[model samples]
Target: MTNEQVIRSFFETVRSGKDPDQAPHYMANEVLAHQINGENRVTVHRTPQNYADHVREMIDAFGTFQLTVEEVISQDPKVYVRWQQRGTHIGEYEGYAPTGKEIIELASAVYRLEECKIVEYWIQIDRLGILEQLKRNQM
Candidate 1:
């Protein structure tokens, strides 16, 4: 599969929390996942199983969600994807209890693929947007 196809499948299957076990099909055995929020950044080493587990946790919290791929661009081994996710807040997140409110999240990621498997990715999420939505309901 091409790098763009790999990313699209990963989002539709693994990231969508539909079939996270499919992570291994698209990700390397050991992958680097970088999370960036403004100037703060953290990198986590993720195995296929670890990545699957993380998706499962999100599914537990968000219930079923719709991930819409807005744009995709590829250059050699790197692919950039911009996406939007919509779901109901059915489970707790970041110390905020589930308010059953509908939530929409926007994020962008750049993934590096080697031999059709994703080896690394850097992702930035609109966390403040999520927090504000949660906070508004709390007041």
Candidate 2:
């Protein structure tokens, strides 16, 4: 499959909550993830196992989640995706107890592919907006 198709399938897998098991098939063994939000930034050297663990955590925190892909663009080894995610907070997340609130958030991701496997990625999400909604529901 093309890089664009690979990314699209990856998102679909994530939307189906099957990311933990399928990540290895789409991502390279030595994947790099850069996540930036305003003044905070984190980088992770991700392997299939570690990526699966992350996906499991997300699934636990956000129950019944759905990711809507707004746009997808690819040029050779690079792919970009604009997406919106909606889910219900059914479990603890980032130390916040379950608020049972539905959240809608936007995010963008850029992926670099090598030999049809995603090798590197950068992701930015509406963290502040999600926190606000969770806080509001708690009050």
Candidate 3:
């Protein structure tokens, strides 16, 4: 699979509302890296394990989240995508209860592919804005 194909498949899976499995097969293992925070605009370099944990956390929190690709730019080993993600806060997340609120957020991811697999991924999203929309912030 080419890098473009890998990135496409990843987005397709998420959009299909399937459980966030098949991640290991979608990403490279050796130097598989990721960055996932509000300020994560670039890959901070990490292992596949980090992304794995992230996926699990998201799944556990949202139960059923959807990531819609607004636009995608693909190259041999690099794919950049802009997306919108929305889900209901139906489970515990970061010590917050399921507010039963649906929140939508803008996000992006940059993937570095190696040998037809994603070796690195960097993600950014407006998390604070999301929290505010959910009305879970006491401050």
lDDT of 2 by residue, 1-139 (tens): 9999999998888535765688889888888899986797888899877887877777788886887899999998999999988888989987799988897888998999999999999999998998898888888
lDDT of 1 at 134: 87
Candidate 2: stretches off by over 4 Å? none
Candidates in descending lDDT order: 1, 2, 3
Candidate models: Cα lDDT each: 0.91, 0.86, 0.69
Q: Which ten residues in a row have the lowest lDDT in candidate 3?
A: 38-47
Q: Which rank order by TM-score, best down to worst?
A: 1, 2, 3
Q: What lDDT score is found at residue 132 in candidate 2? A: 91
TM-score of 2: 0.94
Per-candidate RMSD vs. true structure? 0.9, 1.3, 3.2
Off-target runs (Cα >4 Å) in candidate 1 are: none
Give residue 113's error in model 3 in angstroms. 0.3
Q: What is the RMSD, in Å, between candidate 2 and the native fold over all Cα?
A: 1.3
Q: What TM-score, over all chains together, does every model reach? A: 0.96, 0.94, 0.77
Clashing pairs in 2: none
**TM-score of candidate 1 versus the correct structure, residues matched by position:** 0.96
